[model samples]
Target: MGELNQIPLKTDVLIVGGGCTGVGIFRDLALHGVDCLLIDAKDFASQTSSASSKMLHGGIRYLESFDFALVKEALHEKNLWLKLAPNLCQELPFYLPVYWESKYPFLWMTKVALKTYDFLSGFQNSAHKILRAKETILKLPGIKKEGLKGAGVYYDAIVDDAKLTLECLYDSLLEPNANAFNYTKIDKVEAFGDSYKAELTNTLTGEKNSIIAKKVVFATGPFSDDLLMNLGFSWKNRLLPTKGSHLWIRKNSLDIPYPLVLQTFDGRIIFVIPQRDAILVGTTEIQAKGDFFDLKCSEEEIDYLLKNLQEFFPAAGVSRKDILSTFAGIRPLVKKEGGNAHNTSREHQVFRPGKNLYVIFGGKYTTFRVMGREISSEIVHGFGGTYNPGTTLQALRQPSVFPTFTPWELSEQAVLESLSHEKVRTFSDLIHRRMGLLSLSNWNHKKSFVDFFTGMLDDMSRYIIVNKAEITKFWP
Candidate 1:
């Protein structure tokens, strides 16, 4: 499955995009013992999919809209994720600090939401903890105390999104007939009889090739509409991309009395999540137009986030100077009639526009596996009574990194040690998304970190000398 420049290879399934959705499909198909080929226009997970808020929790906020099904599915999948990749996914306790001046001022109603979340999660992992106002202040001394009420604490999980995506791709590559190449773009796609043909070009090298497959799946997320249009389909309005931005600030001791879900002035929600030595304050949801790849935190967004951060933690030292990094990502949401981006539905869609063509639209990071299974089921049904869908369920427990290793056996530290400096670079790249070390260490990213990483790279250079600048460029 390596470099077929002149050869036109046939496959059972051809997937475009190496994002989470594409890799999820590949995992499902490979488990079913199918012939598949996955191609990405860039390195795997080097897009919006990997650049997520890194929360693997069931969206508790969705309960306000009574989206029980999405909540339930996400909650179940969250547990499955914990059991399958414990090395990468971890349970995190979050706090919801209440303010008397806020619209949702009633602590009782917040308790109701927390209890609902607990019920949805089967009351797992300290489902909800209600604390007095004084207790809340003790936990977060920086919190505004004037109109402060009690707080509701709950459990959710955070994950290393890039690590998970890479492991998924690695697992898929291990399967026979499953191959992935970065910088490969499916330029044009068309139905040929009952099958489909696509012209693929390497975006990096400008090399072109054609591939044919019985089934072709489009998992391009926000860019799905553009790709589908190239395939002669007019499926506009399938998704409206919503841009979300987050800022990473070097943590001070005063930053987190604990993980906080601070209330925004506009009734929106944001998490002041505490990493070991840093705090992540995120997420502004606005309808995004033009380019999805060209996402950066606007001055307006940074100001808005800072104002909100000041409202809750006035003396937390959260200025532009403390910011270590800033990132933005787009959520592929199904186009709705009229509402703010945050109010848009978070449900997923799987549809077939033609015989053997599948397109997945609209889903959150937490429910990817379930989405994969559902789409795989649809693909199996289109195979005309040949393929069995149950195999995917059997393969559900398989780890995307090391298939033989159970959740209990896989080690996060082991994975970190295994990476070369050529492989992992930047403080954020190493701890934040690759090793789960952000949660594990407060002593990360000191002068020692650069030296430690440099030492590792020097050792790796003996075997595979890589251009440090080239490899580290993508990290920051």
Candidate 2:
């Protein structure tokens, strides 16, 4: 029935969810020689993981809420990511322009917080800086000078989120016993005595299967509550599900030379990062009600981002008409109720809702490796096993330098001209992923380039989207 692939299989651990947290756990457990199986309902990193602001930093904004612990841990983890995945993550310089009326005008506050972040990071001080306002504007010529008190220059990083997740999956595949399958859903996870069994179905083929494992983990993010609801244990309601939407614009190449995290009029920080040929900006944190897949950039959010960009780059005078693309994702923040949204806690929690089941919640992308390590360590300890505490840290310390891949040298003409023969899966992927063209003139040329590429790829005689309805035959 239902093309059953009903085969008996067993493992030491079974991990659910394929986002940063789950993948982190997958990598850590695999490295420790723990046999495991991991699956995702959709493609890896396609959900909230794909929707991040694309930053790898010590949550510098967390200082407003005084989340020192999260800042320290995330800051340290930032270094780890840059170290292990040099191809996907790199240091990005950030400038904060101080205005006369802004609440965070004092340079001292910025310095103190950065110093603490640097200290906690131990030896990872390459991404920390303090620059004067004039010096900052010199690097960011587009910065608004009206009432400009000065500025503070600092360091952080920009990352390719989807690629990073893919790297984790690739690393996990290194373990012969470990496997990751996309478009596979976990239909059920029921405890049968001291062990648990999972019912898994391949969404593509309508195949049914099951596996037995000694331990099960639920690393689902915003959906953590719904997944736990069936077990009769209510989650702590830790996440507020704040929606963050971003816009990628193709502004004319300005002398403005560095990644910027400018403060908006409403006290929110918006990033104007300069990738190769374009500049990317955005992130509006509006409390959301729908699931992650349906998230999109609204008109209001778009206008808000434009207004903030104008404030910083008055001469640039960016507007909606200038935007090439937009994206949105919901942040799974711990619920703070009436407390300030920016002040919410980012500390993650691990729970045992049922026998041999563990759930992780409220983890940030920056600290995913540590989160994974901690969860795996707990699982091992729970099973009366022991592992080297420094395994994950050591993994991070290892260098992964690729001598051939170079981003700075690649030209837009060369990239598109090369991909002209390739098929288009979606417009977003073309603009955001393929050539990594964004709003920055260096990163993205413009929608014109995208339109040209579309024409270049429109020859469907070379590619096809096959589904069951169109298929006359099936292959096993």
lDDT of 1 by residue, 287-322 (tens): 888767637888888998888987777776567876
Worst 10 residues of 1 by lDDT: 401-410
The global C-alpha lDDT for each of the candidates, from Candidate 1 onward, is 0.72, 0.69
Q: Per-residue lDDT tens digits of candidate 2, residues 141-254?
A: 767877876676667778877667756766666666576665577887777778887888876667888888899888888877765665456555656777888887775633
Q: Against the hidden reference, what TM-scores do the models get?
A: 0.85, 0.83
Residue pairs whose backbone atoms clash in candidate 1: 139-257
Q: Which portions of model 2 miss their true places by more than 4 Å? A: 1-8, 127-130, 230-236, 251-255, 394-476
Residue 259 local lDDT, model 2: 74
RMSD of each: 4.7, 6.3
